[model samples]
Target: MNTFKDDTLGSIFFQVMRLHHIRSHTLMGMQKIHRGQPPILGLLWDKDGRTQKEISEELHLQPATVTVMLQRMEKSGLIERRSDSEDLRISRVYLTDKGKQIKDNVEEAIKRLEDECFDGFTIEEKLLLRRFFIHMRDNLLKVSEYKEI
Candidate 1:
């Protein structure tokens, strides 16, 4: 029984918080798109008319992953891909009427999730928390850059 208190407590707390945050947000988004909606709606919520490559970059996912998701979404009739008028090589993604119709529902779900996450915080406290997370993200980006070097 190696009961390392400090390290074990911090590690477990961080992992649990991360898992809960991801699970809550994912569930909220999925529920909003319930009843046969596309899986890509989660990504589309950020930028509706982005190309698959753009979506992949923004979401920090591989282009191939985005391509597969888009294909499935297209088959489900939740989105359509149109050839760029100026560049045939580029394809623009647009939400179908069905997709557009669910935007409000998705937005509401996100709001509800956010509210739940910040349930007891004041508005200023919530803003500060947001800033703290942004700083943490920036620090991670810096660490990644250092790794690349």
Candidate 2:
């Protein structure tokens, strides 16, 4: 019988997650979406005109980190930051026309990565795994931070 030695279930989970992250980065990088940008772009593409703070919060990224990525993206002509009319201090992120044009392609790249990762999994199995992972995440969260689904 063969077994993975010195690896607990949690360690295996961590390894899988790391691999998933690396795979996602490679897949998205091919489309010129750097390691830190896809999640930000994904959010904006899904619903444009979000505050920088909101993007940071939604993606669980630091505000400073988001700012740096936003700067890079702005330089790449992918997004523009505009001051809020009511609160000039708050900068809202809007995708450029170039960014909008690539949204579908970016989404497709991400979908390809996801589909590749889940290839061969039956729908029932995929659903069960999703439920398990969500439950595990909820278990790790504080009671007040988690809502039952």
Candidate with top lDDT is 2
Off by over 4 Å in 2: 1-7, 143-149
Q: How many clashes in each structure? A: 0, 0
Candidate 1, 3-75: lDDT as tens digits: 3344686575586577666756586557543322334575666667677787776666678877877787788
- What count of clashes does model 2 give? 0
Candidate 2: residue pairs that collide: none
- Given candidate 1, what's the lDDT at residue 59? 62
- In terms of TM-score, how similar is model 2 to the real structure? 0.83
Candidate 1 residue pairs in clash (backbone atoms < 3 Å): none
Of candidate 1, the 10-residue stretch with the lowest lDDT total is: 31-40
Q: How well does candidate 2 score on lDDT at residue 18?
A: 80
- Name the runs in model 1 displaced over 4 angstroms: 1-26, 29-49, 145-149
lDDT by residue (54-103, candidate 2, tens digit) is 98778776888989999999998999999998998888999999888877
